[model samples]
Target: MSTIKARALVLEEPGTQPVLAEVDVLDPGPGEVRIKIAASGVCGTDGHAIEGTHPLARWPIVLGHEGAGVVESVGEGVTGIGVGDHVVCALAVPCGTCRQCRRGLAEHCNSAARRQAMSGVMADGDSRLRYGGERAYPFFGVGTLAEYSTVRREQVIPIDPALPLDEFCLAGCGVITGYGAVMNVARVRPGDSVVVLGAGGVGANVIQAARAAGASTIVAVDAIPEKLELARTFGATHVVEASADVAKEIAAIEPDGADAVFEVVGKPELLTLCLSLTRVGGACVMVGIPPVGSKITFDAFTLTANRRLLGCRGGAVVPARDIERLVSLYRGGTLNLAGLIGRRIGLDDVFGALDALGKSTFARSVVVF
Candidate 1:
């Protein structure tokens, strides 16, 4: 097999910034393909991994997961994808044969294969990257922070090349997580009231999803006043300052509590607050990536009122199916993907964007190569 030398963001260790390094990208071994990255989204999870909080991340790893690219080559036993095909490298590709996958709950897949992939290895338990004369793993098996990425075929699904790859890339992580929290997990219905804590990237999508579902009221909460104004463009009916008596403010709009409450900030205290704002029989979904070893304490008594606390993983996305759905929505003008992108930056600007995660900002910052 041949090797391709590419410039990639390499994180040598946790609590350290990723540096640009030339890596030898190996040819796909089996059931794998190589991708030439076009655009990658800067996500809050990237910050978590950099802070040494992402449980699946280890040292000497590639630092990207939310991305879209074009297939460059296909390994043996690959089909339905070929060179020049535009695709989104899905972050939550489940092992279809796992027990959870078999049970139609692939989002909760806990099989060994899924675990291996999450830890940044392929089906064969090896990496395709070599940096500084040592093995380097992709972040979650589909690192897109580089000019090129080699990944298992299952991690990507082809999309129409006519659509802009930069915008569709957001669907890989933020859009899917936010939209699916309402549509899949909380099942927000028409005339329902929804509350989204943290009006960042994912929170904006939750607002959009609630709008699409015909919710009567979509309240967006955030500390950043700028993001609250930005959330209005994404379909938020009411914007509340995060520091206010949030529950009391929401109660004024929803006297019986909201039908769905989403905590997208990934703070343990917010999880407890989310449940408090959920109406009886409503759902409170945690859609953010909390740090490893963190604990959330909520009143167990809340469950007795028929309120549900759901932990959302990648919006419980079935990427192959959902990415297509998002594309269709984008085409029909129902999904406003273009408005979600706050900045289209270059790879050199990635650090600036990542640094702005908990601070003031946009719905998304995408690195366009």
Candidate 2:
């Protein structure tokens, strides 16, 4: 097979920082497509992998999952997508034959989870990337941190070419995860009261989704004053600084407590607080990913009230369907895609972007390729 030389951010091992380096990409095999990445969004999940907090991130892998690109070529057996198509690379590619997928729960495909635990290669057990001619794993099968990527056919969702690729790239992960949590997982209805903790990338999207859902009262809680301000622009009806009295403050807005509480900060304490802030028969949705093996506890009495604590995976998204829906929302002006982008950066600035995640005032930093 012919080789394509490209630059990529490679995580040589766990506990070490990722570095920009040269790599060789192989052409797409059967049922795959090669993408010329246009933009990639820096996500908290990437930070977790760099910090060695994520359990499924294999070492010697390329970093990045939320990305957008144009299809460069298609391999044998690939249908529906073709060369020159604009697409978003989905991190979670469902194996249609898996038990979860067979049952219509493709978002939680067990085969995908199992694959994530192994080396970051395709199902064929071959590496699409190589460093110095040695096999290298590409994170989540679509390492968009690079100029080019090879991904399974199912992983690429075709999108409108008119949309700005740099901004729309967020739909691959952060946008979909947050928006789906409201529209799919929690199913926030009109007039519902929603409280979201953490006003960052995902939280900002959640605020907008709630507004689109016609939520009457949307409260955003975060320690950063700037993030809270950004949340307001995304349609937060109320903003509360995260503190010891946060639950009490939310209760004041919705005396019966919020209809749904979303914990985007993956802390055990915050998870518990989410449940407490939820009204009787309300749902506490967990959107943030906590460290593996972390434990959370709550009072049994709270459960008796019919308050539910639920975990959401990628917002239970079926990427192909949801990406198109979110793009439509963006076009209709119901969703603010441009507002979510704090800055446009380059591939070399990825590490700096990850470092500035919580400290920076921006909701998301996109690497414009």
Give all TM-scores, in the order shown.
0.97, 0.97
Q: Which ten-residue region of model 1 has the weakest summed lDDT?
A: 110-119
- Report how far off residue 182 is in candidate 2 (Å): 0.5
In terms of TM-score, how similar is model 1 to the real structure? 0.97
lDDT value, candidate 1, whole model: 0.88
> Candidate 2 on 152-208: residue-level lDDT in tens?
888899988988999889999999999999999999999999999999999999999
**Among these predicted structures, which one has the highest TM-score?**
1
- TM for candidate 2 is 0.97
